[model samples]
Target chain A: MKEPLLPALKMTLLTLVLFSGVYTLAVWGIAQLAPNGGEGEIITHNGKTYYENVGQQFTEDRYFWSRPSAVDYNAAGSGGSNKAASNPDYVATVQARIDSFLVHNPGVSKAEIPVDIVTASGSGLDPHISPKAAQLQVQRIARVRNLPLEKVQALVAEHTEKPLLGFLGPERVHVLKLNIALDNLK
Target chain B: MNTEILGVIAIYILIVLLALPLGKYIAKVFAGERTWLDPVFNPLERLFFKLSGIDPTLEMNWKHHLAALLGINLLWFLLAMFVLMNQGWLPWNPDGNPSMSPHLAFNTAVSFLVNCNLQHYSGETGMSYLGQVFCLMFLQFVTAGTGMAAAAAVFNAMRERSATHFGNFYNYFLKSCTRILLPVAFVAAIVLAFSGTPMTFEGKDSMITMQGDTVQVSRGPVAAFVAIKQAGTNGGGFYGVNSAHPLENPDYLTNAVENILILIIPIAMVFALGFYLNRRKLAWMIFGVMTLGFLLLSLPSIYSEMQPSPIANQLGIDGSAGNMEGKETRLGAAASAFWGISTTATSNGSVNSMHDSHTPLSGAMQLIDMMINSLYGGVGVGFLNFYIFIILAVFISGLMVGRTPEFLGKKVEAREMKIALIIALLHPFIILVGTALSAFIFYHNPEIGWLNNPGNHGFSEMLYEYTSAAANNGSGFEGLGDNTPWWNISTGFVLLLGRYLPIIGPVAIAGILANKKYIPESAGTLKTDTGTFGLMVFAVIFLVAALAFFPALALGPLAEYFNH
Candidate 1:
């Protein structure tokens, strides 16, 4: 007589049901531990002001603007402009971004503008800018804070992470933490 | 290449030792001989069969066995998919990783169950403790066992006189997993744990940074899985960093040992074929040819990487240590480069170093291995690919000499030739077609941010990544922006197709051959157990690769090599 297929079918079904039940519980639990959301304030150039997220919408009297996140859906979505560094489109976008920032902070020269300030990130949704880029904005930030450029540069230094494993990836700066340190500087 | 040399020697020794005991155990299990351990598990085995409605006493032919194999695999397919999709809600996830996106889960499920293990998700960050156990670790044994069962079927086909039956798949699968895979995994895991790879619920979150800041140290149930991951040649890393992670890898001694362990079963199975065939010399010839071919192709890249680049020195980036980019200092250049070539060459895609960051010559060698689809491929599968080539070679020679082709008393015919050709060309087709579509269709797509680099070399790197993924060789150059859905789904499609098609091709060929009347061996029969035949087999492999990949590779990695 042919063997019944029902028993094998039952085992397969049981394994699936048990596996699915445990997996869902794990993800829901981790979400609970994460901070409610990132909180911070806005920096102004000229009379206009902008902040990173919706919660941080403000016309702050003192602060420095980090790199613009392309995650701003109305502005740019979750990607870089994708133009090669040498491409005319990339160069043009950088120029346009520089022109907009210069309009806000008029006294800042073309040379004083950081590359991160003008260039889009790989994700374009990068929450942080390069340290070289951060240092360029240090003078402007200091002048606005009525403090020394060295102190502002130190804050950038504090937030920078050297390469992981001393070699795995590029060195990085966490923009959120640096900006938070700026508030703590007072 | 001292590490690779050590690794190769280690594999040779381990394979020789393990094959006899393992093969004998397999033979006994299939023969229904009682062992000391069998009595203890006899009840469990009976219960499992009773529960599955499979009658242990029923004798079946190859067709019925293949059906059972397919059915069980289907069950695994569904189980893996369900586990991956819902990993977010799984238990023991202290860090709270989310469910894999639908497409990624599908890709991963197919990948692991097929023994490809092409992970889009990071084990430490993406999967919880339980998900790792139920999904990845479990699949390791199942997939490896599947490969062993297939090999045993092929062995049975060769051994049986007139009967058309290959063997029972359920019995083979169960015996392979319980008798072979589990024991080896247990021993290797114990050794690896002793070597300091962690095996606990507690995550290795200890932050140790050279620059005196916090770094997220990735750890998981690595020691538990690393054994089978290597032994089965199913090369998924416990963490995204792969074998480069200090905790996952431990130290130099463990690195060498693990690398050797990975190649041991696959290599020894060459000799195991000899044991099964009762022709030890023929297996040696296969082993010799593969080892020689592997070394000849691998050595140049190894030597090239050892030389420090002048440009690197000028930039003050230390190449003195020999191509240290994308490698952990703990493993060093020689060890990392060795692992890179050996793993990919054997169809184990675990990387100690990033292939993308390697010099152009090194990268080309790796691409070449994939071009041949690395015959010495996955564990039991590699020898099978070699055997297919050997049969094809003999068939072609037979036609030339006006004699019927026979290898080990088995006739090579039209049906077998067609299947062999299909299996041989399967990888190159996926690779060439995938590379062309990605490079041509999506080459200038705005979403392809990672391929934004200038010239054909960058395009080749992207091409290579898809080729590797589709072929189930999961080493990435890190430059490919494969995190997107377009790549995840498309590459996953190629992976699924590449894995199953070649396997299905062989099984179908075996089925056809099973029913065929065996032509008696005569003086005119072309013998396969010779160096000349091995060379001919190599040539067949080379010819297939040349016809399929030469043009695409020239356009991609080759162009990049010359351009730089």
Candidate 2:
């Protein structure tokens, strides 16, 4: 046992150098070649900078609402609420979200609220929402913005992203992008 | 079939192809034979031994091996706790993440030390760069090395007869880290980084959204961390979303790479056993049985996940594209299902899709995989788990045939049987009991609320957490609020017991058998390496897991499935 200790410590140090230093540096070098030089993808709009990949909170009546964020859309820390379905508090939170949505959109019925609209996304930074989720909020946005309903509907269609290869994942809209497009409307 | 499904199949095939050669290389390394890397590593290994005052010739009995393993692990646990708790003052805090709370630090320390890597805290916010590199990644290597070393001790014990001393634990541990884990992790990290995973120390960067809103985007040494996380079967992730994050898994190619890396070492270890024992046919048989079980569970999960969600159908949406909720678009349904089963099967809990959002039957399959975790489990320890089942099968079949039970030429006495039974039984004992206790608490105090989806699905979430902990598979349903004190402390104890006992039990049994007088194979002896024995072991695994977990399954995912 005593005989192997030195070797154990030595190996630990050697591997630490290899794994913690060399390997990390090699990866960093490789990441340098990736898009944005491994930095977060930045999008500029109206003299403000934003991460194109991350979701932004847009709770206004005239804007498309992003998915509820457990971390309040703080991209610095991303996570789900991790509340099990049976937890009464979580159930109430979802219920509250539903009630709030209903109050905001009187024309939409309680059953019309999609699951994504009420439940927080796994990553608080999920940028996209199901097209259905975006469509559900259409009435409220059109009413609040005083935009033609057809015009808002056309914008939703224009911004919708199809599944990869046209058959993978659900059709979805990037809420930040959709809201930006909505703001840009003449 | 779609290209996506075809791509997944191709990757699985590639892993098996790669594992065959990798297994041979691993066998050569452990056996101390001349290998291509010997020139480079041999001198380094000798220097390690010389500097550490290790003779390299000393061997230890089972007790000493266990002591060394446990002692080193305890040391690491303390060190990790210190680093995690004091990270606020420690270096590399560009993001200024605070030290983990004591209970969470305790839980995280134990989780990584046990090779469970079940994270109650999100990596980006909870840990600093120093914590990620020094504390978490460091444990990933050592804990995985400890398990492999223990398995190597068992392998040595089984190979030698009338031997009181198994090979030195330190030697095995060092070799596993240097020869197997480090080399693979080095290459994998580079691959992941090139595929867009960040490997920088820079803190969170503020970016503006297209909507002109500012978002603080977190970045870290994710690529390096992710490689070892999957390779070591330590499933903690750099981001809260785990492999679901684009940086951690940017595209289908990277997704396929991560998935294969998760299963490669565990799968290869099976073949390594065959090479070490000079019993190629036996290894193939065992591999076949494990693969069969894996396919049986995985195919159903894939099929179920590709079917539309019942809720989606009720909403009158076009359900033709299947359940894409909580899954990345690049991975889609088939690849996600494959990853779900592979990760759970190998006890590598990194995920490209959230298990919580899986359809009821797919979720049940994930639970079943972890319950019977021996389907090519984590690295070397996977074979050790299967060995427990093999012993039970030997005893039961021997009783049926009216003969004395023996394995590998050693008499399987009551003492050996007792240890094997304890190891096998302890898994379900902790899982079911813990689930029951949590369920009871949830029932009485709904106000203590941790669940997110109500009814049967809610019950399944609790069951999945305990099962993941007990199996040392760290994947969760993600709907459970597990950071609370009740979860942190409870699962910490479960993780420690689940990891050490399973390892110690199998190694001890192997050691005791190695010291017994040799009994050569005879007509009366059970042919353990045969196809029939493999089938018996398979049956024993199913029977034990089914008997222990069936009722729980009935209440959780099963009920949810049928209800839909």
Candidate 3:
């Protein structure tokens, strides 16, 4: 192994410069023009900056809910519940969420709940929910905000993102963007 | 048809379409043939060689190549250790993260250095800017380039020509970086940066959520790190949650691109082998076997995950959206399930969904993929794994046919046979033993704090860790609270053994076979590239892997699956 030590050392040093120094500078330079200057796309509202992508906690009836987060939407760090699909504790947690949803919205039945509303997202910071999930909460938001049911439904329709190329991915709605739109509703 | 299923199909089609041209380019780069990139990279490569005072064209044998590989890797380990252990006070420590403990540093440094990024330490709080960029990200490029160089050396020896010299490792390594990895990574990084994967030096930003909770959102030079992490099959994440973090994989479109990045290099490497040896049929045969193995594991996972999660089903909550536990709605369960199989198949461990939280059947698929890891495999090492199986297949077939076992016209003697069998058996031996030891310790002591889930699922966590470490497929059941010294140190040893030995074994066998006199093909000679031989190799792989791993799998994922 020592046979190539001299050359290996010199090679390693040069690669450090090539990859860490030069290659990084190249990517960093391109990032200068990226959205939000690659700091991450952010939303500036009232006073604070919110990561447009990172999900925020939105359990209030007036707003559409983000997916349940095991880490409770901790953007400082991210994780999942990591509970097995059959873990009893995890099952109970999902049951509690459903019960809470029922209390919050007497109109919606258990069978109407989208699974996204019950499952804790892997990243805990997932900003998007399936369109069905957002729609499930539309009636609750309409009731709490004193807005017409049609108005809230239209709001969900407006924010609902279609799959790529009209048919390649799951259709989802960004919870933060939709809620901000809801708050802006006249 | 399900749009998410279409999305998975589209990604697979794109992978095959993209891999062809990239594979040809990779072959040209290693062959030292001129291409469009030569004008750009030739001067830079010369500059590197000049600075190092090394000859780029120096002919090296197998031993010389191994010496160079180990030599540089050792230095890389030290550099990684120094940076990781001292990231707290490092120049680019924007987040003010603390340094890792000695044992953690040892684990992390060895993990990334060996190209298996089994990160017990999460990226959000554990690493600084300098550590992410210089240490982990830099290792991603070179470790991948290093693996490719080793593959090129093996490819060189296996060529029809009787060459005493294996190709120069530096030539292959430099070209792999500048031509193969750098160009693709640059474009992909730029794409990801625009797609909200952060590429900045900014520290964590504090923001108030809609619910009036103040939270700190961590951002970094993540686009740069993530691009290579996927492309190089390193699978380390800049975030604690890997690709599941919204910033790392912003949306479905970005998710597709990132998923493509994982398989592109690994698949291209298979085609590269074909182009290098001028054996297109042989490469296709191998690719076919790998793809068959991949689909066998993946399709069932996709179907299983498309069903409702146990929680949703037991509660009778409408789960038309499928198993959403630990999965992003943006990626969806079908896409996530497909990704789980693909990532494990390629030794690219980045996850769009949590494997630990997947449906038990899907979880089992992920485990089995890692257990039989040669399906389009890791960056350069995938073919190397398949090569071991091929050697075994040749030996077995020869015994049945009553002829001398040979591959590429070289005799499969006792020395080569012993090495191949050891390499084949070594993967499962380490994984099982490590899992058993951890299981025993947990059973006896029960206070070591390793498992996060309860009962059989907990055992899967332990099993997944050792399998991930030993397979050099670093995706884990993160449910395993594995930041402790026991988890780190044990898996670190497994990671090193898993990566280097498989690589060294194949290269040694190929090197020995290459130096022997080349015999022209005769009517009686075994045709190793035929469909029959491909089936034989596939059988041998399943037989060896299944024999070694079945009991352990039954104990872990399989038991968990049926219990539910």
Candidate 4:
């Protein structure tokens, strides 16, 4: 009985070691194979910035708009601005974002700037943009990439997530991944 | 409004009538009867226990049991968090999704473990097949069983007199999962599979489209987990979009069946309580109040939609489809319309339609249901809601008669009332405070605008997000940018306190009540089973919700609805 128990215990220990070993190796392989997209610096006009890997790059060509981040680098408090629409600070920020956006995308009208591009997201770190927001950027992106207007529009159209089963929420586009795909496009 | 009311009434009657008999069948299954219809799955249950070396007959006091339950859950939560954080490094990387960051991992784990299935990440794209199965699918079983276990403890509290023992927690937990939740889940999964929800290990579909373009459609072992997820009122969807995915919901019959399963057990707990207390009428009375509250709340929305939208009316589509904006065409008017109400009614926020696209009145109704904290709630937790109201009813009646309050023979004094009020009020407090905090303190900055929805409506979205989180109902009216630490940690924290605090308070109430002897039923005992009492409880719920959040809601969703 003692001999049998000893064998069973050894077998169990061996299986545990082997299972963990396999798991770690598989994870390493997947990580190696993960997306190798472009990286960039998060450069604000104020000349304050930091280096980022692929995840934080906000390229204009990519129709995908990531979730908003409310990280105030100065205050160092990571939070949603949570400012109600009536707040002066909130209104000022939106105006500034819209103003900057208009300056960058020359020849685009004020109405052409999607509110999503100007307004603060609740989390301040959203990675997806509404379909409306993505569509608004279509023309500007087409011109920047020298892609046909229809082709860039088509890309935005394809990436949109229609309401769950066509009935759940508004259509959405993942901005980060979409931008990455845009950069990769010929 | 009237049309919506009629539609809501019709839907509630249908859901309730359907859920009634199903609840009886569930009660029988839980009593350990081997049904001819249900296949024997106890072999799997026993196998799990054997592997874990947990004794089925182990006796434990309530505290020990609660600790064990909490301890096991803590381990599972950490494991899930770790797995989600390391997903890029994990197996079955069909989409090559990255691991969620610390905040998101914490949010997802807590959401499932607490039975609040609010997702910060999209399901189809964010998670791998292995992550979907191991972390999410399994938690459906555990979290749901946790609910039943909590209910069982409460039931023991009500049943016993001057006894500290609240049954065997391990036994109750096993009975809930093995005897009740699993069998129902197994059958539901089979039905879902039969209805076309896919059950497979295949990667996202790589087939060529009719347009001659190669497009990948995400696919997984969805049918198996979905059956229990809804039926147990666990509410987590296999895909990020939840029941909206064709493979997860498939068709009308599956949709209707899943909706009914999500509601039946919770509604039936009224009967379960009746049987346990040996008073079927009492069960019906509680059921009546809940049904009435649900119907009344849903009425405004249903009717609002039936009237033509100026835009839709000109398009020559039926306005009766009632806000078809974000709803599935297959589900259409009746199903999507009903699901919006039912999902909220049971605290299962997996929608078949876009709630944001709902008509103003209808949208407000959905928000109101969250404000009510889903008392006509999920499977076992519904009983907790009923239990809470029962205490309230007793307290009120006791006051009217100028006697000390008594519930099911146990005295309901100041201590009990205070505890009950705190338990009852705590969820609303969280909703109001969290929503206010999210709206007033954290305005969306670039670091947080994932969904990129703008303006006052955007603020409403964030407010609604936290409300759902704090109330532990995982539905959202406005799309949330949840990837940031603010939303993730805040919402994760909301889920935790919202779930555990109310639960712990109720359990403590049960223990306190157990120590008191049950007095014999006498003439002075309020006849709580009457429809009059039902109306009173409904009034109380409405009054409290209305009073607590009227100002905030008016400023947020209501303002947006009017402006939009």
Give iRMSD, candidate 2. Answer: 4.1
Per residue, candidate 1 scores C-alpha lDDT tens digits across B326-429 of 44434545556667677777677877666665666777778777666644677666766666677778887777788777765667777788888878777777
TM per model? 0.74, 0.87, 0.99, 0.72
* Tens-place lDDT digits, model 4, residues B1-564: 233234334445666786666556555544445655445446644554465555555555657666666766676687688778888889887777788878888889899888888887777667886677667766776677777777777776776367776665555665676566665666676666555565555565442311123434455566666876787676777765567544566555677678777677777766666665556787788877777777787656655655554223333322333443344433444456667777777777776655654555666677777777645776677677657767887788678779777777778887878988988888778787777676655554444554335555565676678777866778775346577887888888889987877677777788888878878768877677788877777777776666787887787667766664
Please write out the lDDT profile of model 1 over residues A1-186, one tens digit for every residue.
124345446544443332223222232233233222111123343343333321111112254554443323121112223232223444455567667766666566665554444543323224344455566566667877887878888788887766433442234465545666786687
The CA-based lDDT of model 4 is what? 0.62
Compare the candidates by lDDT and give the number of the best one. Answer: 3
Give the alpha carbon lDDT tens digit for every residue of B166-257 in model 3.
88988888888889999998899989999988988889988888789988999988988899999999999999999999999998888999
Off by over 4 Å in 4: A1-186, B1-18, B25-55, B310-321, B442-456
What's model 4's lDDT at B146?
76
Candidate 4's displacement at residue A4, Å, is 28
The lDDT values for all models are 0.62, 0.82, 0.89, 0.62
The true-versus-predicted C-alpha distance at residue A8 of model 2, in Å, is 5.8
Cα lDDT for residue B73, candidate 2: 80
Q: Which ten residues in a row have the lowest lDDT in candidate 3 chain B?
A: B160-169
lDDT of 1: 0.62
Can you tell me which runs of candidate 3 are displaced by over 4 Å? A1-3
TM-score of candidate 1 chain B vs. the reference: 0.92
The order of the candidates by DockQ, greatest first, is 3, 2, 1, 4
Q: How badly does each model clash, as a count of residue pairs?
A: 11, 22, 0, 56
